[model samples]
Target: MARHHTVRALLVGGPMYDSLYDRLPAFERATGLHVDVVDRLPHPELNARVKREFESGAADFDLISTHTKYAPSQATWLSPLDAELGAEIDDFLPQPRELSRIDGALLQVPRYLDVRLLYYRRDLLGGSSVTVPRTWDALIEAATTLTRPGIYGFLFPGRDSGLFGTFYELLVSAGGHLFDANLRPAFDDAAGVWAADRLAELHDRRGLTPRELPAWHYDEVSASFRRGEAAMVCDWPGSHHLYKARATCDVADRVGLALLPSGPAGIRAAYSGCHSFAIPRTARNRAGAVELLRDLTSTAAQLGEARRGAIPVRASALAQIRAEAAADPAEAHRWELLTRTQEAMIIPPRFAAYPECEDAIWHAVQRAMTGVVSPQAAVREGAQHIVALLARERLSPQPNTV
Candidate 1:
């Protein structure tokens, strides 16, 4: 017999989590455990809030909507779920399946995955006879040839976190990492310089992005791409529906999806992350929280989310998404996007102090992008700051999931 509990959940709100929020009532009814959800914030903000709320006092949340990378850092805040998750490992796709554990403790049950994809305007590019780019240099060439008075070639966020993610993607694709085995900053070398220089040339030299690239948010980038102001964008998969829906997008009909182009490293590093549900160690309703996690990740729930534009965490849901091709070719194509992106997936490093290191690098990226410092100088300075940070704290690199 299974124990039931009334659980309080803190969920990250946004389109990515909409289906889960919408389906909570049914989940409560099915399990007879009331789930009281706190307000949802944007992804990064929600994680920040969770950390704040958890640290302010005793655990206020029994269950939470979190990311796979976060579980490693906050392992103490989360209860081990290995005994609860027996034999369920085979249900998930590779990324989530491998990331669910922290120090060998099953701490999170993944809900959905996020990966970078190449979103482009098929109409414009096809007219130029430009096929999808398979490499970064090719992408740059296409962007250069495609840029004009108003229509830019590439659109990506330029704010701090966005900009950092940008450099991180390039660094990974160029065979570099934020930190090496000894927990020292490793992104200041050749790859970092080239990445910064390329970005500088695109925005300042050739004008491939918005004039106010530094001020742009992710939403603005998506909007520009959706409005056909940009020929292509390297971004997350959420834009697939937005670009395909004629009612919301001007270029919906001409949109084309492709894998993120390979970088100088000769591999397509799939920049990725996932949203997951986790129970707190101090939860008052442990049993109910576990059940809620199970139900939210169920096939029906995942399918509902998939239809609403989220990648399912489970293998069965992925199969169900593939089945959509029989009824609607467009929907099927979307599923195929998920499949292709999964193959090139690259997860960020996980550790309690990873955010601090990320912020330091972000500041450096900003300085380089804004011409406050050359890319080479920015990364060199950033690496120095990181060494100091490492000295102040005992940080260690965790093993990669892949």
Candidate 2:
């Protein structure tokens, strides 16, 4: 029989945590372990606080819920779960598993997956003779097709980081590279210029939305699209569930999800992100924390999470999802979209300075979106900032072997 443990965790307070809280009681009852969840700050602020805690030698967190991409850099501050939970690591979905590893030792185990999809209005596309886009050019044209007096063609979050993250998939898909193998900035080349120009043109030429929409984050972008003010928008899967609920949006039935178009690289990349469970080195009960992680990642817990609208991180949970979809059509559609986009999802390079890079890139993109700077200038500045950050922090390209 597996050993039981009483664990403490500091979880980010948000919709995601609510889902975990709903499932925790059962896991606790089964394992004879108690879970104490503390809601800290928002995503960005929580990350900052974690850093401050580590720097000040006041690390009080046991298990920290965080993104997978930063696991490698954070490995020093995190304990290895691989030795304690090898079998559990093997059960994770490929993408989530890859994201969890840092120098062959898993620093984080994904609790959920975040994948992007194109959200569109079924009424507009079905009623009109306009065909949905299958390519970049076609996407722009379709945006025009859906644009009317009040309704805009596209509804993406235009803020620096929000829009930039989504746009990277397009840039990479379009044969534009952000960072080279040496971990150097490479977004100043010909392909980079073309990609940025096209993104900016969506606002300047094609009628997208709000004019100030670039300043909007996920919530505002999703709210605008769900309320039927925008025709097509690219967003995380969470939007799909929100729009489909009866109490959520009026256009739930009229909403349709599509696979984003493939770019010049012939690779259809979807901007993907994941949230994982990690144990900080400062945990008072490291052994107990790993046990809790093991239970949270079990097949049953993952399936429960999937049913609650988050993507399952375990491969076995997919079967559970398939069975549940057999009973619900809406869930079936959502699952179909996720399965199709699964391979196309892209994980950002895992680096200790990734958060800094992400924040810088987000700021640059926001500046461009708000017209404070040109897209070309924004990319150039972003590249410079990224390179300078690497130098300032002395980040290495590969995992430390010594």
Best-fitting candidate, measured by lDDT? 1
Question: What is the alpha-carbon lDDT for the whole of candidate 2?
Answer: 0.73
Model 2 regions lying over 4 Å from their true place: 1-7, 27-34, 148-150, 204-207, 264-266, 326-334, 397-402
lDDT of 2 by residue, 100-200 (tens): 77766778888778887888888887454866677776777778777887788887777645677766877788787778888898877766665666676
Look at candidate 2 and tell me the lDDT of residue 154: 84
For residues 113-191, could you state the per-residue lDDT of candidate 1 as single tens digits?
Answer: 8887788888777554776788878887889888888799998877756777778778878887777767778888898
The local distance difference test score of model 1 is: 0.77
Looking at candidate 1, the ten consecutive residues that score lowest on lDDT are: 1-10
Stretches of candidate 1 exceeding 4 Å from the true structure: 1-6, 32-34, 129-131, 148-150, 215-217, 326-338
Taking all chains together, the TM-score of candidate 2 against the true structure is 0.87
What is the TM-score of each predicted model, taking all chains together? 0.88, 0.87
Model 2 worst lDDT run, 10 consecutive residues: 393-402
